[model samples]
Structures are given as structure tokens and as C-alpha cells.
Target: MLVEINLLPKKEPRNLSLLFAIVTFSGMILIGAAFLIWQMNEKKEELANVENQVQLTNEILEAKRTKLADFQSASSVQELEKAIKWAEKQPYNLVYVLQKLTKILPERGFLTEFNLEKDSIINLIIQFDTKSEAAYYLNSLLNYKWIDEAVITKEKAGDWEIINNKTPLSDDQLTDLAKKNFFPRYYAEYEIRLNIAELKQAYKSEMEKSKEGNKGEEEGGDSP
Candidate 1:
């Protein structure tokens, strides 16, 4: 066999495993850094979108608040105009009418219901101690300066003892009670016509003064 011995020391196999591992680790780090940057940019875009939505909602609320204020002002003016028109249509001052009616009430009677109808007719329901008291009140109303005609349209009488009895009374007891002259409570309804012509003539000067005052106020309001 031929001799194959070399004088130089045999060269060991090149150790390239460490350099390959370093290159692979560096590539993985670069890929991870790029992904993290992309995620951060996405988060920034989401925050910007939320802020824009909040600003738009605030603008819409502010517009509605302005409209509500204007509506309230218009409603107040409309209500005042309606009240003025109603006052103009009234035939007489309610307070004055009530005062006059109260002054003419009979001493033995009190008004239960009072209704004023068209053409100055008044329907009155009154309670009295006796029927005679009711008749007297009707005569007084006829003679009153403000009333033109007065008539009793309905009359009713009730005894408190009979009405409030819990147990039914025997025939003997009822007969005994009937023997005594007992006057029961009387309720009378009257219809009276007011003297509208006389009333209007008396209040004409005051009415004219009130109308002139109202006209002046309206003119002042229309100026500015």
C-alpha cells in the first residue's frame, strides 16, 4: 500500500451550526417587531373613530336644546291670546255677579246650586227650613232690582228623623209622628230672568273704559 501520511495537522470539519442558528434567530426577531408595529397602528385608528362619534352626538344635542327654547316662547304667547279672547266674550264680571247674588240671598235660605244660562236666565236650587220661606225668597227675588222674573219650578220636603232612621218605624209610631204638626226641610228650585238691559246700561261706562285700555295695550305691544 502506498504511504498517505500528511505533514500538516488534519483540518477539522467546519463548524457552521452556530452561524446558521444566529441568522435564524435574527430573522424571527425582525418578523415579531414588524407585527407589533402593525397592531399598534390598528389601535390608534380605533381610538380616533371613537372620538369622532362622541363629537357628533354632542352637536345633535345642542341643536335640540335651541329648538325647545323657541317652542316654549311660542306656546306662552298663544295661551295669553286665548285668555284675552275668552275674557272679551264674557257678559259680566264673574266676581261682581257672585257678589250681587250673595247679597240678595234670603236669611232663612241658602243657595245649593246656581247656573247662569244664555239670555241672562239663572237657575237656582235653594234649601230652606219651610216651604213658606222658599215662597218668600221667590217674592224677594222678583222685587229685586237686578231680577226681572222669578218663579219656583220644583219643591221637595224631607224629614231628617225619617230619612236617618236605621230601623223601620212601626205603623203606630208613624201615625203618632204624623199627628204632630212637623215642618220638614224644604228644597226649592227657582228660575229667574236677570234684567240684562238695565245691567248693561249701568255698566256701559266701565265697559267702555276697559275696552279703551285694552286697545291701548294692544297698540303698544304691536309697536316694537
Candidate 2:
């Protein structure tokens, strides 16, 4: 009569505190590691972008430098062309001037040095046996149609030793020169200015005449 037999065993209370704590700590660690991985990926992307920008900037700078170099080369060529044109326009003819000088030179005097200067100026060193020859040469230059003014800037006695050394001579020639070096000689340095305006006018007239002559020749040849 007393009590019914219990078939099931009595249930024990389970302690879940330590397991829950371990699960919470492991979940936090996994979340933190995932967040750190995401941050690392973002940093790598930003670094790549910065490197690409730097490369692009360098490429742009190189292109600009190439363009600048090309521009400078073009400018230099243009300047050289302008200088050549200016030179062509200048009314200066060395051959014509030399021919005139040869025609007007004194018979007894010889030119030792001749220099052509800017603004159509001629500097000449002439040696003569007498001072009158130098004076005559200067007067002739002054009276020339092409020469505007002529002046004897310097006059001095010629040195035989200096003049002899100017020419290459053999030993026998040098001995003869030494024997004949007793006579005193004179030299004059002259500066002559050319009439540039008058020369330009003359040159223009000659060019016109030449053109007319050429045209007449062509017309004559074409006539039946």
C-alpha cells in the first residue's frame, strides 16, 4: 500500500556558467579578428590607389617636359632663320669693297694689313718709301665716291726687321735683306668710313639695270 515504485532516475542540475563564458569569449575573439582583417584589406586598397596616383602624376610631368623641349627647339630654329634673313638684308659686299680698294691703292705704297669693321669702316696699314705717298693715298681715299671720310690715324717709321720677318725667306734672302736694311721707311695707319646709304642706292640701281637687261634678252630670244 505504501508508495508507487519510481522507474525513472532522479535528474541532476547542470552548471552552464563556465561553458557560456567560454562561448562568449570565443565569439568576441572571432569578431575582433574579422574586423582586423577587414581593416587590413581597406588599408591595402588605399595604398594601391596612392601609388597609382603618383605614377599618373609622373607620366603627366614627363609629357609636359617633352612638349617644352620641342617648343624650345622650334623657337631656336625660328630665331636662327630670323638672323639669316637679317644678314641677307644687310647691304655689305666684301668683294666689291676689296675691288674698289685695289683700284684706289697708291702705286708706291703697299698695304700690310687690312681689316673690315662694323658700319662699313676700313682700317688699313700702309707702308711707303716716303710720307708724301701715305698723304697722297689718304687724299685719294677721301676723294673716292664710295668713301665718306678718310684719316691717317697714325704715322710711324717702318722697322725693317719686323717687315722682313713677316715673309718667310731663305737664309740667302735674309742675308740680302739685312744688307739692304739701311734705308729708313715710313708707314701710315688709315681709317676709312664708307658711304653706306650711297652704296645701297647704287646697288639698287645696278640690280634694276640687271633685271631690265635680263628681261630684254628673254624678249629678244622669244621673238620669231
Candidate 3:
């Protein structure tokens, strides 16, 4: 009989514990992935909301800027109109202007007629007791700083013309009284119209400042 020998290798026990550990770990990873996906979606929604709010704020600021520009334009127009009105009234103050034409006059020199014209011109008509007094008054007026151009057009002697010899006083006495009234500081009655546009310009500047202040307050009060 032939000896039969069977050489068969025995397989090791299957690793059941390793298979269980792998399956449990895979399930945990799937659950973790689902949680991470949920968190990412929540963050995306929050970012989108923040961007929307920023856009809205920008729109509001632009609208307020537009309104402010419009208000400024309107204010400028109103100010111009008010300035024109003020300039128109500047010529009325010429009556109070002091034109000290006669700096020094002889005791007998007296002013007879004074005329003021609207065309910025000065006209003077005077009668003096003597030609020397007239010369003195004329020279003083020419040297005066207020008189721009003092021109003695007609230096003629005048005899007293009796207009009315009424009961009040004699013409000669009245002439003496007139001479005495303006003695030592006799002024030739002259008309001088000065261009006081400089004063008007200064006043206009102040008026503009006041208007600007009012406008600033209005704009500030409307601020949020």
C-alpha cells in the first residue's frame, strides 16, 4: 500500500473585529460630512444678507446727496435776487454824504445856491462879499480831499439884486445876516453826487454771509 500524504494549509481565523471597526468608522464619517454641509449652507445665507444690507445703505446715502445739491442751487438763486434789490436802494443814501468842499473860508464868504444832480455831478452857485473872499473859498474847496475835481467855472462879482424888499427885513440887512451866519467857515453851496458803490459792495457781502448761515442751518437740521 502507498502512503498518501495530504499537505493542506489551514486558513487563520477571519478578523471579524477589524471588519466591525471599519464599518463603524465609515458611518461616523458620513454623519460628519452631512453636518459640515449644513453649516456651510447657513454661512452662505448669512453672507448674502450682509451684502444686501450694504447695497441698501449705499442707495440711501446717494438719495440724501441729491437732495442736498438741489437745496444749494435754490439757495444761490434766492441770494442773487436779494442782492440786486439791495443794490437798487444804495443811491438813496447820497443825501447824507458830507462833502466838506470849503475847508477854509473868509468871514464874509457865504453860500447862495446848492444844486445836486442825479448824474453824479456837483453844481455850485455862490455870491461873495469880495473877490478875495471868493478866491479864498475856491482855493480851500479845491484843496479839500472830498472834492475830486474843483473847477471855478465863472468867478464874477455880483451886485446885490433885490428880489423882494418885504416887511420882514431889508434886502441889505438880509444879505448881511446871510454873510454873518456862515462867517469864518463859509461854504459855497455845491451839489456833489458820489459813486458810493464801494459801501454797497460791503453791505452785499454781509447779506450774502447771513443767507449762507441760514442755508447751513437748514441743511444741518435735515441731517439724520
Candidate 4:
């Protein structure tokens, strides 16, 4: 038993301790690398989710814009047409009557007094430079195409001849002075009155009446 114990070599404990320390260091490095890889994967997944949400929001905004554009383009024109139709249905057309009157008035003539009654009769006093002009206006009024009738209610000189009160004058002298135009010459005045019952009636009837009168005259001449 004493000879077996003496054959065993002496053991050094430092080599085993060195081997354990190296193994521990290598294991810690491996664990740190695995944790880093896990963190990187989580970051990539979060980035993908955020990108998807942004794309969805962009699509929704584009759809909303398209809907707004369609509403404006399709509905506005119909609304405008409806408004125009409404305007046509209104009844008070004073503007149109005024336009027609403006066309019928003479070039050099002007109205001195004008009045329209509640019963639709219009009193119009027209002034002209000469009696011939006044007569022409009356003829034109007789030929009017819009009113029922236009008649000359009154005719007179526009300017009155005022004599000096101090001078004694006879009626014949006044008449002579008027004829000789010792005062300013008065322009011709005509009062035209008409009814606005119809837009176009009187002229045609007047033409027919004149034709009938001419026919009667012709027949009388032919009878003997």
C-alpha cells in the first residue's frame, strides 16, 4: 500500500481554474448577442406597422377628395338651371315694357308730362318744334302696335304770349301780334292719352277700319 501512493504524480490546481474562467466569458458573450438580435427584430416589426398605417391614411384622404370633387361638378349646374327657370316665372316685367316704349318714341320728340293711372290709362304730353311735327306724332300714335288706343286729348301752344299790362291793346291787336310772333314763338304741344290693356291690337284694327272706309268711298264713286 505504501508503494502505490508513491507512484502518483503531483497535481497543479491552477490549470483547471483557468479553463473554467474562459468558458464563463464565452457563455456571457453568446447571451449578449442573442438579446441584441431579438431587439433588432422587434424594431423592424414596429416600423412595418407604422408604414402600413400611413399608407391607409393617404388612401382615405384621396377618397374624400374625390367625393368632394364629384359633388361639386355634378350638382352645381343643375342648381343653376333651376335658378334660371325660377327667374322666367316671375310676372312683373316693367323692364320689358320700358324697352318697348323707348323703341317707339320719336328721335327729336320728348315728353313734357307723363302719368300712369291705377286703371291702366297713361296720360302723355309730347312737345315738338312745329305743328307738323305734332301732327306726325299723332299719326304715329294712331299707328301704335302696343296700346288699345292713343288719342290727342288737347292741343295748344307750348309758350304763352304775355302782353305788357301797361299797354292798352285790342283783341285784334293781340291776334295780330300772335300771328306776327312779336313774342317768342311757341312750340307745338299735343296731349296723347292711351290705354295699356293690350300689347299689340289697335294698329291692326285701325288699318282695317281705314281700309273699310276707302272701300266704301270707292263703291260710292263707282255707283254713278
Candidate 5:
């Protein structure tokens, strides 16, 4: 019977080998895709970790810099204070000492040469109308607490005085640099030198010793 005949050949038993090949290929593709996804996720995690580390390092560096700046500011202030204290401890004030010296000068008397020595000796010159005024000025200088000794080194009279190498003062009757003695008009100039060192205890002791020696000498002289 020519039934609708099993056409082709029994539908070719379903080609199992080809189906197995397709399934294997599909499974391999799936496994490859999953591995790629896992690698991408791991790389993202590593990048995140690196970013966090960089941020933390920057924060620490900034903190250290701020601390260093503060330390430097404080150190500068402390150093300035130390420098001021050192300046305050210094013993000499030239301007103040000069002012003190100027205040003691007489109205008519003026200084010609005044110089300070390295060893605290003062070489000074003062000109006045009369020797009496000059002597008075010298005694007054010695009375100052700062002066240890005052001595007049020389005295001279001149009608014309060479106050310095460059400047000369003409003491005629008009300028009164010179006053008339019996002979001529002349000015008296005094050259004085002095030492200034105030050691209170030592000076007191010296005075005591001098008084004792004088008393002993007087007693011996009286007995003889």
C-alpha cells in the first residue's frame, strides 16, 4: 500500500552528534562570558582600593605640613624674645651717657675735646673765663657718682685758641675768649682727664683705709 509513504528516510534518526556539538559550543561560550565578567569585577575592586590609599596619604601629608608651620611660628617668637632679653642686658648706652655729661657743663663753659677711651678714661677739655670757674667745674665733675677720679692735666692762657686742628676761636675783648689780666686779654683753657667706674664697695673701703692711715700718721706725729 502506497501509504503517504514515510517520505524521506525515516526523518534521519534526529542527528544526535550535531545536537551534542551545538550544546558543547553553547556551554563553552557561557563559561567564557562568566570568566570575563569575574575579571572585570576584580579589576574594579582593585582600582577602588588604590584610590582610597591615595586619598589617605594626601590627608596625612597635609596634616604634617600644618603642624610644621605652627611649630615654626612658635619657634620664631621664642627666638625674638631671647634676642630682646640679650639686648636689655647690655651695659652701655652712649646717648644717655652723653646727655648726662652735657647736663653738668657750666653756662659759660663749653667743651672742646671730649673722648672716651677703651679703658673707661675720659679725656676732656673745657674753657672758661677764669681759672676759678674751671676749678669749680672740675670739682663738680669729681662729685658725680660715676667719676672715680678727676684730675686737671694742664692749663693754658691764649688770646687765640686752636680748639681743634681745623677750628680756631679768636678770643679778643669782643668774644671774651680771653679776659684781660694786667698784661693782656687771654682765655684760660683746662685740659682734664678722668676715670669713670663705679664700684661702690671698693670705693668705700678705700676711703676707710685712707682715713685710718691718716689718723695713725697724725697720732705718731703728735707723739714725736
Candidate 6:
């Protein structure tokens, strides 16, 4: 009996599924690489813009600082204060003016008005017991060192006088010159304007000197 054994050939499964999986994974890697590259470019652009803005801001701030400094230097109050400070340093003596006035006043004369002005002018109104006394006062003021360009503005006769015995003004005839007060007895009233231009000029000059002094101090402080 020759029985032929029937044998079946071993069947091989298809590898299509593994090939599909590999293709999908490779495509996903490529897409991921593209996205990463795009993100890197966007970040670089943003950084550049930020840097530019910072540079512009710095330039604007520096310009404003320069303008403010210029304005402060040109202010009117600054100029006036500078002038006043300089006046304080000057060697002007108001006491000398008072002394000069005292030296020139006549015994029979009294000051009815005294005005000092910023423009370097002194206005004085004198009331005298006699016209001659007023004349003497004018002559004495003219001879004073601090008085210049004296001019009488008005003159009139008055009859008011005060006699003080304590001043030792004992002139005869009026006999009791020190004890007698008289007004309108040949009286003369006059207004005199004197120039004090020198005082004003001196004040201005001193102010300039002070500015120079302050500048020197600031410069010294800045050194080292």
C-alpha cells in the first residue's frame, strides 16, 4: 500500500502593516522638524524689535535732559537771584551815606522827607528857619563826597520850627535859639535830588563777582 502523505506548504503572512507604520512615523518626524524651525525664526524677530525700541527710548530721554538744563540756566528768577547774591558781596557802605548827610545838614534845617530809590537816586526835602540856612545846607551837600548832581526840585517859605536846647544850637539873636521853635520866620523849604548812581553800579558789579565765585566753587567740587 503506497499511501501518499498529503503535506501543506507553510503559509507566509504579508508585511504591509509594518511598512505602513514606518512611513507614518517618518512623515510625523519631518512635520515636527518644520514646526521647530518656524518657531525659532519668530523668536529671533521679536528679540530684534525689542532691542530697537530700547535704543530709541534712550535717545529720547537724553534729549529731554539737555533741554531741561538749558531752560534752568535761562530762567528770569535765576538771573535776578544771581544779581542779588552779587550785591551782598560788594563793599557798598550805606553808613557812609548817612554820615555824609549828617555832615551837610545845617543846624537851622530839618529833614521833612527822605526817599531812597533803587535807581541810585536820593530825594531829600529840607525845611529851614531861613532861606540862608537852606542855602547853607545845599552848599554843604554839594561838597559831600558821596553826593553828586544835586538839584533842587521846589522851594517855599515855611513858618514851623522846633528848638531843642539839648543840641547846643545856642545861636545869639534868636537868643534862646536852643529854647525857641520858630516857623515861617524867613523860612525856606526846598527839595533836593541827588544821584547815587555809583551805589547801584557797585551793587551790579558785586553780583557778577559772586557768580564767578560760585562757578569756581562748583568746578572745584567736580574735580577728581
- Note the Cα lDDT for every prediction shown: 0.73, 0.77, 0.60, 0.60, 0.64, 0.64
lDDT of 2 by residue, 76-161 (tens): 99999997786677677655666666677655456788886766788988877656667777877777677888899999865643
* Tens digits of lDDT, candidate 1, 122-208: 898987655566777787777656678888899886573344354476533543453465433568898888777666664676678
Across residues 1-224, which tens digit of lDDT does each residue of candidate 4 receive?
36545667787557877788899999989998999999999999999999999999999999998998898877898788886785465432334444544455555455666554433456666654344556666676667545556566676654322342335765345445645664432243333344444442544465589999999999999996
Give TM per candidate.
Answer: 0.41, 0.41, 0.36, 0.35, 0.38, 0.36
Candidate 6 regions exceeding 4 Å error are: 1-91, 160-179, 182-224
- Which of the numbered candidates is closest to the native, going by highest lDDT? 2
lDDT, candidate 4, residue 71?
Answer: 89
What is candidate 5's TM-score against the reference? 0.38
Q: How does candidate 4 fare on TM-score?
A: 0.35
* Error in Å for residue 63 of model 2: 47
Model 2, backbone clash pairs (residues 3+ apart or across chains), number: 0
lDDT for each residue of candidate 5 in 79-195, tens digit (9 for 90 to 100): 999977854653544444556566776565667776655435667676665555667777877776666667777787543333322355333342353433432222334333333
Off by over 4 Å in 2: 1-90, 159-184, 203-224
| lDDT (C-alpha) at residue 33 in model 5 | 99
In terms of TM-score, how similar is model 6 to the real structure?
0.36
- Model 1: lDDT equals 0.73
Candidate 1 collision pairs: none
Candidate 2, pairs of clashing residues: none
List runs of model 1 lying over 4 Å from the truth: 1-88, 160-184, 202-224
- For model 3, the stretches where C-alpha displacement exceeds 4 angstroms are 1-16, 92-224
